[model samples]
Target: MFDTWSVRELANADHPPSVPLNPMGALPCIARLEDETGSSWWVAATANRWTTTHVLVLWRPDPRNHRQERLVWLRKADVRPWLHKEQATRT
Candidate 1:
């Protein structure tokens, strides 16, 4: 299923989202996702070393241990207009 989320919702998540990384190291971009279950997930998008596209890493804070986190990788295309729109507003 598909769902839309606002940049405000992400910024208000319990745990602040992680910053995306670059070849030179961490960049200032911060992305987040909201799932069907209403759980908020943090995301970090970094450019691939070889490709012009980006790799999005989704993260959720561990329920059992807040200090720990879980993550999964996704293509930037999955987030579509939301991610693209958010990035545009940032600049």
Candidate 2:
């Protein structure tokens, strides 16, 4: 299942209760997020547990840098489900 909402909607909505970190002190969840720009991202909760404002995302690697994995931070509110018409039809 996916949480389908826009950044603006998430900002105006109430947040869910804080989720507990795993024993290793990480938020153990992965989500497929879509931004307002229509870009899709696969993100994992970062090791930083001091705040709930941002998440770490694996960036699309360039062909020349295939051996490297690029990570970046994105606002939590900007993360939303990647919905498509085809997916809806199948469901």
Candidate 3:
């Protein structure tokens, strides 16, 4: 996604980011999904915006500096079928 990526480090004097300049460039991202069969599927997708099914974020604060670190993002989905399958397993 356009917003999911950033420069890992300052690669140039101008500090240009590694993100592609193309508006339709594929997002530098990946996803891992596990089904009821205990098999996992890795999904590859392109994006120009952040998708709930493509990412998530968690944040923690730095107690020493009293400042919070950047949010962490994860890729997951809220598929109804998956929910039902999980519920079935519990029962």
TM-score for each prediction? 0.28, 0.30, 0.24
Error of 3 at 67 (Å): 45
Write the residue-wise lDDT of candidate 1 on 1-91 in tens digits.
2233222243222321444454433232344565545665444433221123433433334334445443333444433333465567854
Give the C-alpha miss distance for residue 37 in model 2, angstroms. Answer: 17
- Which candidate, 1 or 3, has the higher lDDT? 1
**Cα displacement (Å) at residue 27, model 1:** 2.8
- Worst 10-residue lDDT window for candidate 2 reads 5-14
> By summed lDDT, which 10 consecutive residues of candidate 1 come out lowest?
45-54
List per-candidate RMSD values in Å: 11.3, 10.8, 14.1
Candidate 3 Cα outliers beyond 4 Å, as residue runs: 1-26, 47-91
**Best lDDT goes to which candidate?**
2
**Which regions of candidate 2 deviate over 4 angstroms?**
1-52, 61-65, 84-86
Alpha-carbon local distance difference test for all models: 0.38, 0.42, 0.31
Taking the tens digit of each residue's C-alpha lDDT, what string does model 2 give over 17-71? 5533533343434445454566555544223232376554443233245465434
Scored against the true structure, residue 62 in model 2 reaches a CA lDDT of: 39
